[model samples]
Target: MSVTAAPGFVAAGVAAGIKASGNPDLSLVATADGKPVAAAGVFTRNKMTAAPVITTRAHLEATAGHAVAVVLNSGNANAATGQQGIDDAEAMCAAVATELGVDASQVLVCSTGLIGIPMPIDVIKAGIPSVVAARSADGGQAAATAIMTTDTVAKQVVIDGGGFVVGGMAKGAAMLSPNMATMLAVLTTDAAATPEQLKAALVYGVADSFNALDVDGCTSTNDTVLLLASGLAGSVDEAALNDAVARACASLAAQMCADAEGATKVVRMTVTGAASDEEALLGARYVSRSNLVKCSWYGCDPYWGRIASDLGSCGIDFDPSKFSVSYGGITVCRGAIDADHDAAAVASHMAGRNLEIVADLGLGTGTATILTNDLSHAYIDENMGTS
Candidate 1:
């Protein structure tokens, strides 16, 4: 509902035959009027990246951050395939650009799913025509649904501004701990903005959401977060636009957390009293990445030891004696463990669909919050020998 929620953007998804499950594996998004729009993107930091990520990066640079369309495919990552992979990615871009009567450099490409396999370029190319033809003003929902891998539900968000709207769609559930950004997210706005404005808004806005998300502490080869400004509704306040973008990103990120692989509850982690904001984030990330801590969370156990131990590994100057931890605002540990709290009350708090884990470093007045999911057997079962 969100990506297409903005004006002047149409989208569609089609079964490209790249997926063995017979699901729609390819999608296309472009301006309704077939014109270039200001765009900016943040991609994966992994050294071994998919072909689409490489192509999109180069195109954004070559075109001066102006693009008319983005073509994406699922089921094959097109990574580690050397020059052929690059060629295939280029062909996908060319196919769309040619059909839309725009320069090849004005098109971006994205791919997700299995890694280290050759992409079915022929099938993807054949599906491009059908995908482009199916573009509709109300097609964002279909596009979101088509990008799913292991996710149980599609994630989308829309925020209305005074004279415009900001909307987005994202697909991600696992392999999430992003370095620069996460997953395949495309955000659009109807407000008039420069390419530089779009870039600054996105680079800063993601820090509040995707940058803080950690599903399994893994980064994929195909992470991409692209923002496009259509300028259909005319000029908008710069501050308002930025805030709208951030809100839309945060909403989608929360959805992704709830839909994480084998996850039951979403853990909202806040690390306070660190030496600095950077240190607080580092501490929270370490705790989020700890499988031991995630397992404890699944058991509804207020195991402060795991949080204390993992935060210490961030290499920050931490004092164990001054550390304290809490779950659902119930202090389970302070200097020494606090055993006077009602056990039933604490467990009941932990059993909720949304739980909070707060840590106090007791060092300084720094704070950071992140979203993660509890570890469960379904996560293991879903990932075993699959990709």
Candidate 2:
């Protein structure tokens, strides 16, 4: 149990023939025990959002962030299908609501995969009954598996905060960038929290985790991060609750980066001593999103020039000569120039599957961290043949 690790939650995953690969592609997570939960979500800000994302946003708004269930599907992103797509999304929500004896507005929907294809509504609808029947506390793993696209492994995390617990499942592996990344994550908690608290916690947690990951610099139309609080553990320590949620979200984010499509290196970039944290984050994101830098990392090249040039382009005023760069803690460049370190040693250190890059702006005490992956040919092959 992951998302279902919390009290008052149950989940199910079933195959509906949505994916051409015949993988499990439909899932349901509900605040079971016949109760509604306090829920809040952050969706992709993409102008061309998916139908399910639009429908879910409306549902959350109409119900004041109160939701009973989440209907998630993979392999067919119900996007760009016009009115039919909207209707299909709404129908999916309504069907789940009817089966669970909850209002349609209490349901949220999400879909991922190839865009602009009509949803197989009938096939999916026919499977809803069985999926509903399969819902159980132990079904979290199934639910996690069903919501995966290019992900090689299911991402889940559980954090116990003394009297309360925060648990979640996430999927992403590609089409990832800042601004929430191409991901779908649902976090559940058993703590007593109001709608406002849930919303605030989700916002805080997502910004520090999901928003910090960049795989290919392409955001998904169906990206969503939703949180549901059952309040089954009674009131919780607010600080502790927030910490648990943040830790869980961060854990899932790390897993997604590590499992990123065709990525051999999980790169953690940290920027320190900027004028402000925002500037530090901007600088880090600029470097992480640079294909040139990612390509360099993939080959274990100590191309400090690629990293230095991007940081210079970040528009942050800093003495180029004063900044320094490192690869896996091996300082290769200092004072904006080569540190006279052994070039072979630095490149060898970068050969590992795990890599860390640090850039100190030497401006102020501001700092930021970003999680990203090295670009590889496998990523190109997987994404190119997805249709």
Candidate 3:
């Protein structure tokens, strides 16, 4: 169990024939009692938004961040289809709401898969009852499995917050970047909380977790992270709730990076000594999303020049002559030039499945870290075809 592990939540996934392979494509999550819970969502900043995203945002607003259920489908993104797409998303929500005896505004929707494709509304509607009937505590794994697009494995996390537990599941592999990507996540907690408190915790959690990962630098139209809390497990302080949610999101982020499409190495880029933490993040993001840098990582090359160039291009004030770069704790570049060290040791370290690169700007006390993966020929192969 993932989401259901938090208690007060029931989840299920079913094969609604939305996928050509007849795999599980529909997933539903709701309170165990079919009542609304405190809800907060973070969506993609992409301007070319998907229909499901629009509907879900509106529902959250209409209900003032209270929701009874969430319905999601894979294999068709229901994006870029204009008004028809919006209607289809609403219809999906309506069907789920009808079955649960809840208002449409209390049911949120999300879709992922190939973009620009219309949703199979009738097939999904017909399967709503079955999914609703199948809801149980044991269905969290199935729900996690159903949301995957190109992910090879389900991502789930459960964290103990002293008095309460926070559980979550997420799906994403490619198209991962800062500000989110082609990902959908649901977080549940039994700890008592208001919608405003949930929003604050989610914002704090997402900032350093999901929003810190950069895979292929492509943000999706359907990226969503929704947190729901049922006041069943007694009360928890805001700080504890925020920490627990952040821990869960961070775990999920690491899992996504490990399962990234065609990735061979998971890399952590730490930027330090920036003029500001924001500038440090800018520098880290530039290096993480640089194709040159990613390709060098794939080849097990400690190409310090690429990192230097990326940091310089971040538009942040950094003294190139004073900055330094290190790979796997070994200084590779010092004072913006190559440093003589044991080349064999550095090469051996880069060959591992996990690695870290550090860039010290020698500016001020500001730091940030970015999690990413190496670019490979297989990544191109996977994206060259249909998404």
Q: Estimate each model's TM-score.
A: 0.97, 0.97, 0.98
Q: What is the C-alpha local distance difference test score of each model?
A: 0.88, 0.88, 0.92
The residue-by-residue lDDT of candidate 1 on 1-387, one tens digit each, is: 679899999999888899999998898889999999999998889998888999999999999999999998888888888899999999999999888899999999998888878889999999888989999999898888878877788888999987999988899988988878337899999999998999888877788899889988998889999999999899988999889988988998899898898998899988999999999998898888888999988998888888888887779868877888888888888864564677787899988989998999999998999899889999999889856
Candidate 2 residues lying further than 4 Å off, grouped into runs, are 178-180, 342-345
Relative to the unseen true structure, what is the C-alpha lDDT of residue 89 in candidate 1, on a scale of 0 to 100? 97
Ranking by lDDT: 3, 2, 1
Model 2 C-alpha lDDT versus the unseen true structure: 0.88
- The sequence of per-residue lDDT tens digits that candidate 2 reaches over residues 203-300 is 88878888999888788888999999999899987788888888998999999999998999998999898999999999988899899999998988
> 19, model 1: CA deviation in Å?
0.7
| Cα lDDT, model 2, residue 203 | 80
The best candidate in terms of lDDT? 3
CA shift at 358, candidate 2, in angstroms?
0.7
Summarize candidate 3's per-residue lDDT along 315-353 as a digit string, tens digits.
998798889998999998999989998899899989999
Which one wins by TM-score: 2 or 3? 3
Alpha carbon lDDT at 249, candidate 2: 86
In model 2, state the lDDT of residue 8. 92
* Residue pairs that clash (backbone atoms under 3 angstroms), model 2: none
TM-score top scorer:
3
